[model samples]
Target: MGTIDFDGLAAALAVHGLIPRGGIDFAKGETAPPGPSGASARAVLLVGHAGSSIWPHFQAWRATQPAGLADPLDAWSRQVIGAVAVRFGARAVSPSDQPWLPFQAWAMRAEGLRPSPLGLLMHPVWGLWHAFRGALLFDNALERPRNPDSLHHPCDACIGKPCLKACPVAAHAGGGFDYPACLGHVRSPSGSACASGGCLDRRACPVGTEYRYEPAQQAFHMAAFASPSIASAPTSGG
Candidate 1:
């Protein structure tokens, strides 16, 4: 058979809502990850659309989950990207993996992405509506992904700073993320707005309006944010 077509591979995966976020050529970057895969030529990051492209399929699949399936979102993402990695003879990784890599740094270098007011990586076309699901290490080197259309950091240009003001409890204001406050509000009856529509802070960003996730997708994230078990989950980055 012909050599594996990485571009075609990317295009095919995109159909399933798994898109390439960025890639690094270990042979070329000034800095490299420890234990650089001698078996692989490059590392590529993949992002899953939690509330937009991924919603329809995820909902359909989640409907079939038996009662005991814990962390269905993570499980489903691993299964999907894991299958893709296997098909291409590559290694797959999850965002929640131990010994976490700096995904935010990778995204910034790969696509010139910048952080929003709340520190989530902001995409010119996606704002805060997107998330990093997983990544892959390929046995072959691939082309560097394109920079997002707008080189300017949208947040820098925004005068309103609505994201900082939208939270009911000011969870994201005053230079720190008040996680306990956010969780408390989300779990309370007052969190109905965030529960149904997604984070008011995230939704306030005006950029990438067309790329916003659907309400169904938003609800899923809100539910997760509201989960008590997640209070202890470690998160330096997404």
Candidate 2:
């Protein structure tokens, strides 16, 4: 029940390549994220990064950890974000947690985002280059941050929708993702381009081209998407 020094918190997160994407107040009729002690969170602030902002930070942390760590990104996210939450007297939760938190819904509400052809929330500026890694849940309502962009959804104005065509297997065609097809392609010999450079469909998006993730970052995510069971493996110590 104290005013949040949100700016200070943002600065702290930035050191670890995280940004405060936005927030929602439960008092405003928004669904609350599960809070500590079985209570409902009064407010939730999303923590994430745009483009390859977190890549270097991630790589640096990865270097310090034991080899072959499972779900290194998730571990790093929980480690960094959880510490920030504790420092701010808040509870931190991740997208990978059990019972599945509503991160996508929370993201759309917080940033006024719409889904893209690739199923990731499309940002006018970051396009498909951003992600919500975790969230900070507070006991008191916090003011919602204003979205800087006012333009309607970017996909509405897209003429070619090249993202639909860039995939060789057309895994994203027909308004649905062919997860099995996508996984097959990424693991096969023909998947080298996607395996090394990232998803062709995602890279084809003209929006937020400047913020596109580097190949290493892209490859990392693609690996995770292709082999999800890796996440369940025991994580190496940080």
Q: Give the TM-score of candidate 1.
A: 0.86
lDDT of each: 0.71, 0.83
TM-score of each: 0.86, 0.91
**Cα TM-score of candidate 2:** 0.91
Residue 95 local lDDT, model 1: 70
Q: Write the per-residue lDDT of candidate 1 for residues 1-238, one digit (tens) a residue.
A: 2244668667757767767666665556544433224543455655556337776767788899997577888888888888887777667777777666666676677677778888888876777767777777665555555555446788888998999999999999989889889888888899898888888888888887787888877787778777766744433222
What does candidate 2's lDDT look like per residue over 192-222, in tens digits? 9998899899899999999998988888877
